[model samples]
Target: MDSSGWFMWALLSAVFAAMTAIFAKLGLEGVDSDFATLVRTAVILIMLAAIVLVLGKWRNPLQLGGRTWFFLVLSALATGASWLCYFRALQLGEASKVAPVDKLSLLLVAVFAFVFLGERPGAWSWFGIALVGAGVFILGLKR
Candidate 1:
């Protein structure tokens, strides 16, 4: 596998996402989930803003087209909603169960991409989605 590639970054994302569930779950102890989510979002905002400032990506936003702005804003809203729901879920349930069901977004994304973006998954992609769904059902669906 290439060390410096998109796949590597995506793998890192998965690792970090797993860590996020554990860390957030731990943080939710004796705290309101919504308040925790607010604090987390604030920290993320600050960190991301710092990174963008340091990297001089401030100009990047100005360069975005209207479509890019629209989509990104929509994505931001969706992400916020997801985080809120996820934190609430994590607070109320076990991370092992919550994370997998949360990840069913992957399966939904495949279907959504096909319908909305005209991005059809090939046979293996479909197979992988099915496999992941089944795995999640087995591992995360049971109480």
Candidate 2:
């Protein structure tokens, strides 16, 4: 895959993420959100582990550098927190509404990248990010 391949991969990720919201909303019925998150995490762990093993990508965590391990651990923690909140939100609200609010993260990511990663989005990129923020707010409005 080349640099241009990323868009297709990202598009597929969006598709799967959409499915995830719908499926999780239905699955949350009669289940505690925290418990549901644990189950979902376990399933993800198993599935990713299988994929890694099948692809010969199983790696020894101990062999990774400290910086890599630290960032990976932090990212995992953040993902866990996000999943917990997302599941709880889905449990309490309509999936359509919850998912759009959840996408406010897209706006946050742009800001975070600029501040922490020294990323500078071009004018149009910032415009797109602003549009995403506006869309989230519009979708989340009580109507």
For lDDT, the strongest prediction is 2
The 0-to-1 C-alpha lDDT of every candidate, in the order given, reads: 0.93, 0.94
Task: Give the per-residue lDDT of model 2 (tens digit) for 1-143.
Answer: 57879989998999999999999999999999999999999999999999999999988888999999999999999999999999999999999899989989999999999999999999999999999999998997778
What is the C-alpha lDDT profile of model 1 across 1-60, one tens digit per residue? 876698989989999999999999999999999899999999999999999999987885
Distance (Å) between predicted and true CA of 51, model 1? 0.7
Local error of candidate 1 at residue 65 (angstroms): 2.8
Q: Once all C-alphas are superposed, what RMSD does model 2 give against the true structure?
A: 1.5
Task: Kindly report which residue stretches of model 2 are placed more than 4 angstroms away from their true locations once superposed.
Answer: 1-4
Best by TM-score: 2
